[model samples]
Target: MPANIKALKARIRSVDSTMHITKAMELVASSKIKKATARMEESRFYRRVMEEAFADLAKTDSPYSKTTDSDAPRLYIAIAGDRGLAGGYNNNVFKQVKAAYREGDMVLPIGRRAVEYFRHHGAVLYSEDYTSSEKLTSADCAAIGRSVTSAFDEGTIGAVYLVYTEFVNMLTQEARTKQLLPLVPDEGEGEETHTAGTVYEPDAETVLNALIPEYVGGITYCLAAMSFASELAARRQAMDTATKNASDMIDDLNLRYNRARQGAITQEITEIVAGASE
Candidate 1:
């Protein structure tokens, strides 16, 4: 074997090693995507139930809509990813959050990326660096729910709103803001108005208290599902890109190896012919 061919074999070995690593990463990401997708599906059901509960309570003329003080501060719960490479998934939420903020509003950033983004802009009232995993359980949503509600009760925040990506479909997701406190009645809906005025079972305020927390829970659950799904989709895409890049590099390296082998083979043949003639 010529020295040139030997070197080419070594280069091929290095490329093979790289391919193995990328393939392993792809498999790992695929498994995570499966688990994350299941969690997103389960959370969807919880979200739907919560929405239905809120809709029912609204029919009772819940006082939750009318009980709000004028002099209160607004809170923003901005959820972003800790790491990026998933395209605009995290940036979309950040953009929406920046667009939604008004003067004198406070922010509660979730995820390390969100905290870093908002740190220089304004006051960060609260932040969670890394909570929630590939699969978001009810407990995860509830924990976050408790923190925001606690802030509201302490008068540290008045209206709490969440800004994050909403997974619409496999290929389409969008950034959205949802009100998490002072639960509002679903817009364009009202108590069934008839010639006879509507009546409440006990009272409007009574029903509102019972319904408000459920509304918050629903929003939290939905946000978790959407965020998790977005993460998986992003990661899958990132891994796919990396695999393609590795393949391209291997192609280039193989081309170099082939040319080097040809050159060495020609040199050896020429040397043998010259020796025979001498």
Candidate 2:
């Protein structure tokens, strides 16, 4: 066989192996995305309810509804994926966070990638408890909420924002930065029309204070779920593209290998005939 033919064959084999790996990754990501999206949907419903409750509270004279001073420092809770190979999933969120970052601001990174990115840039880290996206739980979010709420209560940070990827669909994921603190009540068309008339047990202010942490935790968990879904969707799409490209390369390499092999055989036969005639 010709050396070119051998090299082509090796290249085809390498591509075939890569194709298999990418196909498997695609399947895994597909499965994970389904679960992540389902969880995201459920969390979104709960978050909406929490938001409505907060909006009603904001209508009253509760202290939680009061806006913080503009000069107060900001705290950003950034959510990213723990692993890479998910296209631009992590990068998008990080870019949004970096763009909005300012001096004296603190960062609470949720995933390992977020932690690393902020730490490398010398951002002040709030807490390192929740570092893995896959293993995040309500308890983890609650802890994070408590930490930020503590800071806000102590006047350490004035405003709080959540930086994460919003899962629109498999084909579309958007990085978003949303304010989380001071309980900005939802307004406009999406706001709930009917306000409950139920009275608070003790007082509205006390209830608002107690519900604020829970609401924050719920929103944190919801955003994390959405980010996870977006990550899986991006990974699935990337792996699928890689697998298709590998398949195309292997087909081209196989064609070249066949032509090289046929050429080598024809040359050998011609040489044998010439030598015999001589």
Question: Mind sharing the TM-score for model 1?
Answer: 0.70
lDDT of 1 by residue, 88-184 (tens): 8878888887787776778877666777778866665566533333334566566666666676667767788888787776566788898766665
Model 1: how far residue 115 lies from native, Å: 4.1
Q: Residue-wise lDDT of candidate 2 within 222-269, one digit each (tens)?
A: 989999999999999999999999988988888888889889999999
RMSD of 1: 5.2
Runs in model 1 deviating more than 4 A are: 1-19, 55-73, 102-104, 115-123, 129-137, 153-155, 182-184, 187-205, 260-278
Q: How many backbone clashes does candidate 1 have?
A: 0
Query: Estimated TM-score per prediction?
Result: 0.70, 0.90
Candidate 1: C-alpha lDDT: 0.68
lDDT of 1 at 86: 64
